[model samples]
Target: MLSEASNFWGLFKSGSKEREFRKAVEQIIGEKPSNPLLYQLAFRHTSASKETNIGGFRESNERLEYLGDSVLGMIVAEYLFKKYPFKDEGFLTEIRSRIVNRESLNQVARKIGLEKLIQFDGQRIAHNRTSMYGDAMEALIGAIYLDKGFRFTRSFILKKLIANYFDLDAVIQTNTNYKSILLSWAQQEGKKIVFEIVQENGKHHHKEFVAQVKVNGEAISTGGGWNKKKAEQEAARRACESLEIKSTQ
Candidate 1:
Protein backbone atom coordinates (compact mmCIF):
# COMPACT_ATOMS: atom_id res chain seq x y z
CA MET A 1 0.00 0.00 0.00
CA LEU A 2 1.23 3.46 -0.77
CA SER A 3 1.58 5.50 2.38
CA GLU A 4 -0.42 8.71 2.57
CA ALA A 5 2.76 10.72 2.18
CA SER A 6 3.80 8.74 -0.88
CA ASN A 7 0.41 9.19 -2.51
CA PHE A 8 0.64 12.94 -1.97
CA TRP A 9 4.14 13.13 -3.41
CA GLY A 10 3.19 10.93 -6.33
CA LEU A 11 0.34 13.31 -7.17
CA PHE A 12 2.58 16.34 -6.69
CA LYS A 13 5.61 15.02 -8.65
CA SER A 14 5.20 16.97 -11.87
CA GLY A 15 1.53 17.95 -11.40
CA SER A 16 1.17 17.48 -15.15
CA LYS A 17 -0.69 14.16 -14.82
CA GLU A 18 -3.20 15.72 -12.52
CA ARG A 19 -3.43 18.79 -14.72
CA GLU A 20 -4.05 16.75 -17.83
CA PHE A 21 -6.61 14.68 -15.97
CA ARG A 22 -8.39 17.82 -14.80
CA LYS A 23 -8.38 19.19 -18.32
CA ALA A 24 -9.87 15.98 -19.68
CA VAL A 25 -12.54 15.92 -17.01
CA GLU A 26 -13.38 19.55 -17.65
CA GLN A 27 -13.61 18.83 -21.34
CA ILE A 28 -16.05 16.02 -20.62
CA ILE A 29 -18.11 17.64 -17.84
CA GLY A 30 -17.64 21.28 -18.74
CA GLU A 31 -16.31 21.95 -15.26
CA LYS A 32 -13.36 21.16 -13.00
CA PRO A 33 -13.35 17.92 -11.00
CA SER A 34 -14.34 18.13 -7.34
CA ASN A 35 -12.44 15.00 -6.37
CA PRO A 36 -8.87 14.66 -7.54
CA LEU A 37 -8.70 10.94 -6.79
CA LEU A 38 -11.60 10.28 -9.12
CA TYR A 39 -9.76 12.00 -11.96
CA GLN A 40 -6.58 10.07 -11.07
CA LEU A 41 -8.28 6.68 -11.14
CA ALA A 42 -10.09 7.63 -14.34
CA PHE A 43 -6.71 7.57 -16.07
CA ARG A 44 -5.21 4.74 -14.03
CA HIS A 45 -4.57 1.92 -16.48
CA THR A 46 -4.02 -1.66 -15.24
CA SER A 47 -0.52 -1.61 -16.75
CA ALA A 48 0.54 0.97 -14.20
CA SER A 49 -0.25 -1.42 -11.38
CA LYS A 50 2.32 -3.93 -12.68
CA GLU A 51 5.04 -1.30 -12.58
CA THR A 52 4.35 -0.13 -9.02
CA ASN A 53 4.51 -3.66 -7.53
CA ILE A 54 1.65 -2.57 -5.28
CA GLY A 55 -0.59 -4.03 -7.91
CA GLY A 56 -2.69 -6.01 -5.45
CA PHE A 57 -2.89 -3.17 -2.95
CA ARG A 58 -4.05 -0.63 -5.49
CA GLU A 59 -7.08 -1.79 -7.45
CA SER A 60 -7.33 -1.39 -11.22
CA ASN A 61 -10.20 0.61 -12.70
CA GLU A 62 -11.93 -2.51 -14.04
CA ARG A 63 -14.67 -2.49 -11.42
CA LEU A 64 -15.39 1.16 -12.12
CA GLU A 65 -15.41 0.44 -15.82
CA TYR A 66 -18.12 -2.15 -15.38
CA LEU A 67 -20.21 0.27 -13.39
CA GLY A 68 -19.62 3.04 -15.88
CA ASP A 69 -20.66 0.82 -18.75
CA SER A 70 -23.98 0.10 -17.08
CA VAL A 71 -24.46 3.73 -16.16
CA LEU A 72 -23.65 4.83 -19.67
CA GLY A 73 -26.15 2.41 -21.14
CA MET A 74 -28.93 3.54 -18.85
CA ILE A 75 -28.21 7.19 -19.46
CA VAL A 76 -28.16 6.77 -23.21
CA ALA A 77 -31.30 4.66 -23.15
CA GLU A 78 -33.14 7.21 -21.08
CA TYR A 79 -31.98 10.02 -23.32
CA LEU A 80 -33.19 8.23 -26.40
CA PHE A 81 -36.49 7.38 -24.81
CA LYS A 82 -37.17 10.97 -23.87
CA LYS A 83 -35.79 12.52 -27.03
CA TYR A 84 -37.78 10.33 -29.40
CA PRO A 85 -40.93 9.69 -27.46
CA PHE A 86 -42.60 8.04 -30.45
CA LYS A 87 -39.79 5.63 -31.36
CA ASP A 88 -40.43 1.94 -30.84
CA GLU A 89 -38.25 -0.36 -28.76
CA GLY A 90 -36.49 -1.79 -31.81
CA PHE A 91 -35.60 1.63 -33.13
CA LEU A 92 -34.39 2.80 -29.73
CA THR A 93 -32.25 -0.28 -29.25
CA GLU A 94 -30.56 0.12 -32.66
CA ILE A 95 -29.74 3.77 -32.01
CA ARG A 96 -28.30 2.91 -28.61
CA SER A 97 -26.20 0.17 -30.17
CA ARG A 98 -24.70 2.57 -32.67
CA ILE A 99 -23.95 5.14 -29.99
CA VAL A 100 -22.38 2.82 -27.41
CA ASN A 101 -20.56 0.38 -29.61
CA ARG A 102 -16.76 -0.05 -29.61
CA GLU A 103 -16.16 2.45 -32.40
CA SER A 104 -18.29 5.13 -30.79
CA LEU A 105 -16.72 4.76 -27.34
CA ASN A 106 -13.24 4.89 -28.86
CA GLN A 107 -14.15 8.11 -30.62
CA VAL A 108 -15.29 9.63 -27.31
CA ALA A 109 -12.13 8.45 -25.55
CA ARG A 110 -9.88 9.91 -28.18
CA LYS A 111 -11.75 13.22 -28.17
CA ILE A 112 -11.29 13.63 -24.42
CA GLY A 113 -7.56 12.75 -24.37
CA LEU A 114 -8.29 9.48 -22.56
CA GLU A 115 -5.89 7.72 -24.93
CA LYS A 116 -2.88 9.70 -23.77
CA LEU A 117 -3.51 8.90 -20.10
CA ILE A 118 -3.91 5.15 -20.57
CA GLN A 119 -1.22 3.04 -18.89
CA PHE A 120 -1.07 -0.29 -20.64
CA ASP A 121 1.51 -2.99 -21.18
CA GLY A 122 4.11 -1.72 -23.64
CA GLN A 123 3.69 -4.68 -25.97
CA ARG A 124 -0.08 -4.35 -26.10
CA ILE A 125 0.16 -0.58 -26.48
CA ALA A 126 2.58 -0.96 -29.36
CA HIS A 127 0.24 -3.37 -31.15
CA ASN A 128 -2.63 -0.85 -30.83
CA ARG A 129 -5.50 -3.28 -30.65
CA THR A 130 -9.16 -2.32 -30.12
CA SER A 131 -10.14 -4.35 -27.06
CA MET A 132 -7.34 -3.08 -24.84
CA TYR A 133 -7.91 0.62 -25.46
CA GLY A 134 -11.69 0.21 -25.41
CA ASP A 135 -11.61 -1.64 -22.10
CA ALA A 136 -9.26 0.95 -20.66
CA MET A 137 -11.64 3.73 -21.61
CA GLU A 138 -14.56 2.01 -19.89
CA ALA A 139 -12.42 1.40 -16.83
CA LEU A 140 -11.65 5.08 -16.74
CA ILE A 141 -15.35 5.97 -16.79
CA GLY A 142 -15.99 3.47 -14.00
CA ALA A 143 -13.25 5.08 -11.96
CA ILE A 144 -14.84 8.46 -12.52
CA TYR A 145 -18.15 7.18 -11.16
CA LEU A 146 -16.52 5.76 -8.05
CA ASP A 147 -14.41 8.83 -7.39
CA LYS A 148 -16.89 11.55 -8.23
CA GLY A 149 -20.35 9.95 -8.43
CA PHE A 150 -23.11 9.52 -11.00
CA ARG A 151 -24.23 13.13 -11.18
CA PHE A 152 -20.85 14.33 -12.33
CA THR A 153 -20.40 11.42 -14.70
CA ARG A 154 -23.81 12.12 -16.19
CA SER A 155 -22.94 15.76 -16.55
CA PHE A 156 -19.77 14.84 -18.38
CA ILE A 157 -21.56 12.38 -20.61
CA LEU A 158 -24.41 14.67 -21.56
CA LYS A 159 -22.70 18.01 -21.99
CA LYS A 160 -19.37 16.93 -23.38
CA LEU A 161 -19.69 13.40 -24.76
CA ILE A 162 -23.21 13.36 -26.13
CA ALA A 163 -23.82 16.99 -27.01
CA ASN A 164 -20.41 17.70 -28.46
CA TYR A 165 -19.51 14.42 -30.11
CA PHE A 166 -22.63 12.62 -31.30
CA ASP A 167 -25.44 13.68 -33.55
CA LEU A 168 -28.12 12.04 -31.46
CA ASP A 169 -31.04 13.05 -33.69
CA ALA A 170 -29.39 11.85 -36.87
CA VAL A 171 -28.17 8.65 -35.23
CA ILE A 172 -31.64 7.79 -33.98
CA GLN A 173 -33.16 8.19 -37.41
CA THR A 174 -30.50 6.50 -39.55
CA ASN A 175 -28.91 3.93 -37.23
CA THR A 176 -31.47 1.27 -38.02
CA ASN A 177 -31.75 -2.06 -39.80
CA TYR A 178 -32.50 -0.58 -43.20
CA LYS A 179 -32.26 -4.02 -44.76
CA SER A 180 -35.19 -5.24 -42.70
CA ILE A 181 -37.27 -2.25 -43.70
CA LEU A 182 -36.24 -2.62 -47.33
CA LEU A 183 -37.11 -6.31 -47.37
CA SER A 184 -40.51 -5.57 -45.88
CA TRP A 185 -41.13 -2.89 -48.45
CA ALA A 186 -40.02 -5.16 -51.31
CA GLN A 187 -42.32 -7.95 -50.16
CA GLN A 188 -45.16 -5.43 -49.95
CA GLU A 189 -44.33 -4.46 -53.51
CA GLY A 190 -44.77 -8.16 -54.50
CA LYS A 191 -41.02 -8.76 -54.85
CA LYS A 192 -39.22 -11.87 -53.61
CA ILE A 193 -36.19 -11.55 -51.31
CA VAL A 194 -33.74 -14.15 -50.02
CA PHE A 195 -30.74 -14.11 -47.68
CA GLU A 196 -28.15 -16.83 -48.22
CA ILE A 197 -25.38 -17.68 -45.83
CA VAL A 198 -22.17 -17.90 -47.85
CA GLN A 199 -19.57 -18.68 -45.18
CA GLU A 200 -19.36 -19.68 -41.54
CA ASN A 201 -16.09 -20.12 -39.66
CA GLY A 202 -14.25 -19.23 -36.48
CA LYS A 203 -14.08 -21.00 -33.14
CA HIS A 204 -17.37 -22.51 -32.02
CA HIS A 205 -17.77 -19.89 -29.31
CA HIS A 206 -16.91 -16.94 -31.58
CA LYS A 207 -17.98 -18.06 -34.99
CA GLU A 208 -18.90 -15.52 -37.65
CA PHE A 209 -21.30 -15.79 -40.57
CA VAL A 210 -21.38 -14.00 -43.89
CA ALA A 211 -24.70 -13.48 -45.67
CA GLN A 212 -25.92 -11.98 -48.89
CA VAL A 213 -29.38 -10.65 -49.57
CA LYS A 214 -30.81 -11.29 -53.00
CA VAL A 215 -33.93 -10.01 -54.74
CA ASN A 216 -35.22 -11.27 -58.08
CA GLY A 217 -31.95 -13.17 -58.77
CA GLU A 218 -29.86 -10.02 -58.23
CA ALA A 219 -27.59 -9.69 -55.24
CA ILE A 220 -28.52 -6.55 -53.35
CA SER A 221 -26.19 -6.43 -50.32
CA THR A 222 -23.80 -8.49 -48.23
CA GLY A 223 -22.85 -8.31 -44.56
CA GLY A 224 -21.32 -10.36 -41.74
CA GLY A 225 -22.34 -10.99 -38.17
CA TRP A 226 -21.76 -13.41 -35.33
CA ASN A 227 -24.66 -15.51 -36.56
CA LYS A 228 -26.39 -16.25 -39.85
CA LYS A 229 -29.63 -14.52 -38.92
CA LYS A 230 -27.95 -11.30 -37.88
CA ALA A 231 -25.78 -11.24 -40.98
CA GLU A 232 -28.82 -11.76 -43.19
CA GLN A 233 -30.74 -9.05 -41.44
CA GLU A 234 -27.87 -6.60 -41.83
CA ALA A 235 -27.49 -7.39 -45.51
CA ALA A 236 -31.20 -7.11 -46.12
CA ARG A 237 -31.32 -3.77 -44.40
CA ARG A 238 -28.44 -2.41 -46.46
CA ALA A 239 -29.98 -3.71 -49.66
CA CYS A 240 -33.29 -2.11 -48.86
CA GLU A 241 -31.70 1.30 -48.17
CA SER A 242 -29.60 1.19 -51.35
CA LEU A 243 -32.52 0.18 -53.53
CA GLU A 244 -34.79 2.77 -52.01
CA ILE A 245 -32.24 5.55 -52.61
CA LYS A 246 -31.74 4.45 -56.21
CA SER A 247 -35.45 4.33 -56.87
CA THR A 248 -35.95 7.83 -55.50
CA GLN A 249 -33.06 9.29 -57.46
Candidate 2:
Protein backbone atom coordinates (compact mmCIF):
# COMPACT_ATOMS: atom_id res chain seq x y z
CA MET A 1 0.00 0.00 0.00
CA LEU A 2 2.82 2.42 0.89
CA SER A 3 4.61 1.69 -2.40
CA GLU A 4 1.42 2.34 -4.39
CA ALA A 5 0.84 5.69 -2.59
CA SER A 6 4.43 6.79 -3.28
CA ASN A 7 4.02 6.08 -7.00
CA PHE A 8 0.77 8.04 -7.14
CA TRP A 9 2.39 11.04 -5.35
CA GLY A 10 5.33 11.04 -7.77
CA LEU A 11 3.07 11.10 -10.81
CA PHE A 12 0.96 13.98 -9.49
CA LYS A 13 4.05 15.96 -8.36
CA SER A 14 5.78 15.60 -11.76
CA GLY A 15 2.83 17.09 -13.61
CA SER A 16 2.55 20.02 -11.15
CA LYS A 17 6.28 20.72 -11.45
CA GLU A 18 6.04 20.74 -15.24
CA ARG A 19 3.25 23.30 -15.17
CA GLU A 20 5.18 25.61 -12.81
CA PHE A 21 8.28 25.27 -14.98
CA ARG A 22 6.35 26.17 -18.11
CA LYS A 23 4.91 29.28 -16.45
CA ALA A 24 8.37 30.46 -15.40
CA VAL A 25 9.69 29.93 -18.93
CA GLU A 26 6.87 31.95 -20.37
CA GLN A 27 7.60 34.76 -17.96
CA ILE A 28 11.31 34.93 -18.87
CA ILE A 29 11.22 34.42 -22.65
CA GLY A 30 7.77 35.97 -23.21
CA GLU A 31 6.82 32.63 -24.83
CA LYS A 32 7.06 28.88 -24.27
CA PRO A 33 10.67 27.73 -23.87
CA SER A 34 12.15 25.55 -26.62
CA ASN A 35 14.62 24.19 -24.05
CA PRO A 36 12.34 24.04 -21.03
CA LEU A 37 15.07 22.57 -18.81
CA LEU A 38 17.31 25.61 -19.26
CA TYR A 39 14.49 27.94 -18.20
CA GLN A 40 13.83 25.72 -15.16
CA LEU A 41 17.48 25.93 -14.09
CA ALA A 42 17.54 29.69 -14.55
CA PHE A 43 14.61 30.16 -12.18
CA ARG A 44 16.01 27.77 -9.56
CA HIS A 45 17.49 29.69 -6.64
CA THR A 46 20.24 28.06 -4.58
CA SER A 47 17.88 27.72 -1.61
CA ALA A 48 15.20 25.89 -3.58
CA SER A 49 17.61 23.11 -4.60
CA LYS A 50 16.63 20.58 -1.91
CA GLU A 51 12.97 20.62 -2.97
CA THR A 52 13.67 20.64 -6.72
CA ASN A 53 15.92 17.54 -6.33
CA ILE A 54 18.23 18.74 -9.14
CA GLY A 55 21.38 17.81 -7.13
CA GLY A 56 24.76 19.47 -7.82
CA PHE A 57 24.30 19.43 -11.60
CA ARG A 58 22.40 22.72 -11.58
CA GLU A 59 24.21 26.06 -11.20
CA SER A 60 23.06 29.24 -9.49
CA ASN A 61 22.87 32.68 -11.17
CA GLU A 62 25.91 34.10 -9.35
CA ARG A 63 28.30 33.49 -12.27
CA LEU A 64 25.76 34.96 -14.66
CA GLU A 65 25.48 38.07 -12.45
CA TYR A 66 29.21 38.72 -12.82
CA LEU A 67 29.05 38.49 -16.61
CA GLY A 68 25.95 40.67 -16.72
CA ASP A 69 27.61 43.34 -14.59
CA SER A 70 30.43 43.71 -17.11
CA VAL A 71 28.03 43.63 -20.04
CA LEU A 72 25.74 46.27 -18.52
CA GLY A 73 28.62 48.60 -17.67
CA MET A 74 30.06 48.36 -21.18
CA ILE A 75 26.71 48.82 -22.85
CA VAL A 76 25.69 51.81 -20.75
CA ALA A 77 29.13 53.43 -21.13
CA GLU A 78 29.09 53.01 -24.89
CA TYR A 79 25.57 54.32 -25.16
CA LEU A 80 26.36 57.43 -23.10
CA PHE A 81 29.56 58.16 -25.04
CA LYS A 82 27.86 57.95 -28.42
CA LYS A 83 24.83 59.93 -27.23
CA TYR A 84 26.89 62.75 -25.70
CA PRO A 85 30.10 63.24 -27.70
CA PHE A 86 30.73 66.67 -26.14
CA LYS A 87 30.34 65.52 -22.51
CA ASP A 88 33.51 65.44 -20.38
CA GLU A 89 34.60 62.48 -18.25
CA GLY A 90 33.33 63.87 -14.93
CA PHE A 91 29.97 64.73 -16.50
CA LEU A 92 29.71 61.27 -18.06
CA THR A 93 30.56 59.56 -14.77
CA GLU A 94 27.78 61.43 -12.94
CA ILE A 95 25.18 60.48 -15.53
CA ARG A 96 26.31 56.84 -15.40
CA SER A 97 26.04 56.91 -11.61
CA ARG A 98 22.45 58.08 -11.87
CA ILE A 99 21.65 55.40 -14.42
CA VAL A 100 23.42 52.32 -12.97
CA ASN A 101 23.01 52.92 -9.28
CA ARG A 102 21.33 50.24 -7.12
CA GLU A 103 18.10 52.24 -6.94
CA SER A 104 18.03 52.66 -10.72
CA LEU A 105 18.60 48.98 -11.45
CA ASN A 106 15.95 47.93 -8.94
CA GLN A 107 13.53 50.31 -10.59
CA VAL A 108 14.23 48.61 -13.91
CA ALA A 109 13.70 45.18 -12.36
CA ARG A 110 10.38 46.24 -10.85
CA LYS A 111 9.31 47.67 -14.20
CA ILE A 112 9.76 44.27 -15.82
CA GLY A 113 8.07 42.34 -12.95
CA LEU A 114 11.20 40.21 -12.49
CA GLU A 115 10.82 40.18 -8.74
CA LYS A 116 7.65 38.09 -8.70
CA LEU A 117 9.18 35.06 -10.46
CA ILE A 118 12.38 34.86 -8.34
CA GLN A 119 12.55 31.49 -6.56
CA PHE A 120 13.85 31.46 -3.00
CA ASP A 121 13.14 29.91 0.37
CA GLY A 122 10.65 31.59 2.68
CA GLN A 123 13.37 33.27 4.77
CA ARG A 124 15.35 34.60 1.81
CA ILE A 125 12.21 35.68 -0.01
CA ALA A 126 10.85 37.43 3.06
CA HIS A 127 13.82 39.79 3.19
CA ASN A 128 12.86 41.32 -0.16
CA ARG A 129 15.95 43.53 -0.40
CA THR A 130 16.69 45.77 -3.35
CA SER A 131 20.23 44.41 -3.81
CA MET A 132 18.98 40.83 -4.09
CA TYR A 133 16.36 41.72 -6.68
CA GLY A 134 18.86 43.84 -8.65
CA ASP A 135 21.39 40.99 -8.67
CA ALA A 136 18.76 38.57 -9.95
CA MET A 137 17.80 41.01 -12.69
CA GLU A 138 21.41 41.24 -13.88
CA ALA A 139 21.76 37.48 -13.78
CA LEU A 140 18.60 37.15 -15.89
CA ILE A 141 20.15 39.52 -18.42
CA GLY A 142 23.23 37.33 -18.63
CA ALA A 143 21.06 34.25 -19.12
CA ILE A 144 19.20 36.06 -21.90
CA TYR A 145 22.53 37.01 -23.51
CA LEU A 146 23.67 33.38 -23.40
CA ASP A 147 20.40 32.07 -24.82
CA LYS A 148 19.53 34.73 -27.43
CA GLY A 149 22.98 36.19 -28.31
CA PHE A 150 24.30 39.75 -28.00
CA ARG A 151 22.39 41.39 -30.85
CA PHE A 152 19.02 40.31 -29.54
CA THR A 153 19.90 41.26 -25.95
CA ARG A 154 21.23 44.66 -27.05
CA SER A 155 18.13 45.41 -29.08
CA PHE A 156 15.92 44.34 -26.17
CA ILE A 157 17.81 46.63 -23.80
CA LEU A 158 17.58 49.56 -26.18
CA LYS A 159 13.90 49.09 -26.92
CA LYS A 160 12.51 47.74 -23.63
CA LEU A 161 14.78 49.40 -21.07
CA ILE A 162 16.73 52.44 -22.33
CA ALA A 163 14.21 53.93 -24.71
CA ASN A 164 11.26 53.31 -22.39
CA TYR A 165 12.70 54.73 -19.15
CA PHE A 166 15.84 56.81 -19.58
CA ASP A 167 15.85 60.35 -20.99
CA LEU A 168 19.35 61.30 -22.22
CA ASP A 169 18.80 65.03 -22.54
CA ALA A 170 17.25 65.39 -19.11
CA VAL A 171 20.05 63.42 -17.48
CA ILE A 172 22.79 65.52 -19.12
CA GLN A 173 21.19 68.88 -18.43
CA THR A 174 20.57 68.21 -14.73
CA ASN A 175 24.09 66.85 -14.18
CA THR A 176 25.46 70.07 -12.73
CA ASN A 177 24.25 73.23 -11.02
CA TYR A 178 24.59 76.76 -12.53
CA LYS A 179 22.84 78.60 -9.71
CA SER A 180 26.05 79.50 -7.86
CA ILE A 181 27.38 81.42 -10.85
CA LEU A 182 24.20 83.47 -11.01
CA LEU A 183 24.38 84.28 -7.29
CA SER A 184 27.92 85.60 -7.73
CA TRP A 185 26.76 87.67 -10.69
CA ALA A 186 23.91 89.15 -8.66
CA GLN A 187 26.28 90.06 -5.80
CA GLN A 188 28.67 91.76 -8.26
CA GLU A 189 25.76 93.72 -9.72
CA GLY A 190 25.17 95.24 -6.22
CA LYS A 191 22.16 92.88 -5.76
CA LYS A 192 21.75 90.89 -2.53
CA ILE A 193 21.72 87.11 -2.49
CA VAL A 194 21.75 85.05 0.72
CA PHE A 195 22.51 81.34 1.15
CA GLU A 196 21.32 79.80 4.41
CA ILE A 197 22.31 76.31 5.53
CA VAL A 198 18.96 74.85 6.56
CA GLN A 199 20.10 71.39 7.68
CA GLU A 200 23.21 69.24 8.03
CA ASN A 201 23.87 65.58 8.77
CA GLY A 202 26.60 62.94 8.84
CA LYS A 203 30.04 63.15 10.52
CA HIS A 204 32.28 66.24 10.44
CA HIS A 205 34.66 64.77 7.81
CA HIS A 206 31.78 63.36 5.70
CA LYS A 207 29.10 65.94 6.29
CA GLU A 208 26.16 66.65 4.00
CA PHE A 209 24.46 70.05 4.11
CA VAL A 210 21.40 71.51 2.44
CA ALA A 211 21.42 75.20 1.53
CA GLN A 212 18.73 77.46 0.19
CA VAL A 213 19.61 80.59 -1.81
CA LYS A 214 17.34 83.61 -1.73
CA VAL A 215 17.56 86.71 -3.88
CA ASN A 216 15.81 89.91 -2.72
CA GLY A 217 13.65 87.95 -0.26
CA GLU A 218 12.56 85.40 -2.88
CA ALA A 219 13.89 81.85 -2.63
CA ILE A 220 15.67 80.89 -5.87
CA SER A 221 16.93 77.36 -5.36
CA THR A 222 18.06 74.70 -2.88
CA GLY A 223 21.01 72.32 -3.12
CA GLY A 224 22.86 69.74 -1.05
CA GLY A 225 26.60 69.01 -0.89
CA TRP A 226 29.50 67.88 1.28
CA ASN A 227 30.24 71.42 2.42
CA LYS A 228 28.48 74.71 3.04
CA LYS A 229 30.28 76.61 0.25
CA LYS A 230 29.63 73.91 -2.35
CA ALA A 231 25.99 73.55 -1.33
CA GLU A 232 25.44 77.32 -1.51
CA GLN A 233 27.24 77.50 -4.84
CA GLU A 234 25.08 74.70 -6.26
CA ALA A 235 21.92 76.47 -5.16
CA ALA A 236 23.08 79.75 -6.64
CA ARG A 237 24.19 78.08 -9.86
CA ARG A 238 20.76 76.45 -10.26
CA ALA A 239 19.05 79.82 -9.63
CA CYS A 240 21.22 81.48 -12.28
CA GLU A 241 20.49 78.81 -14.88
CA SER A 242 16.77 78.84 -14.14
CA LEU A 243 16.53 82.65 -14.25
CA GLU A 244 18.74 82.89 -17.39
CA ILE A 245 21.11 85.35 -15.74
CA LYS A 246 23.71 86.03 -18.49
CA SER A 247 26.38 88.33 -17.01
CA THR A 248 29.20 86.34 -15.39
CA GLN A 249 30.60 89.08 -13.15
What's each prediction's TM-score?
Answer: 0.60, 0.54
lDDT of each: 0.66, 0.64
- Identify the leading candidate in terms of TM-score: 1
Kindly list the per-residue Cα lDDT of model 2 for residues 76-174, writing each as its tens digit: 888888888998987677777667655567778777766555555543333243254666667766776777777766776677778887887775555
For candidate 2, the per-residue lDDT at 49 reads 41
Q: RMSD, model 1, all Cα superposed?
A: 7.7
Q: Write the per-residue lDDT of candidate 1 for residues 1-249, one digit (tens) a residue.
A: 432322443553477856865776676556677776655655555444433356457655566678778888888898889988998998788788888876678777777666665544443233143344556567666766766688877776777778889987676556355555765677678888877998886654346788998888888889877657667767876786677632221
> In angstroms, how far off is 57's CA in candidate 1?
7.6
- Against the true structure, candidate 1 reaches a TM-score of 0.60
TM-score of structure candidate 2:
0.54
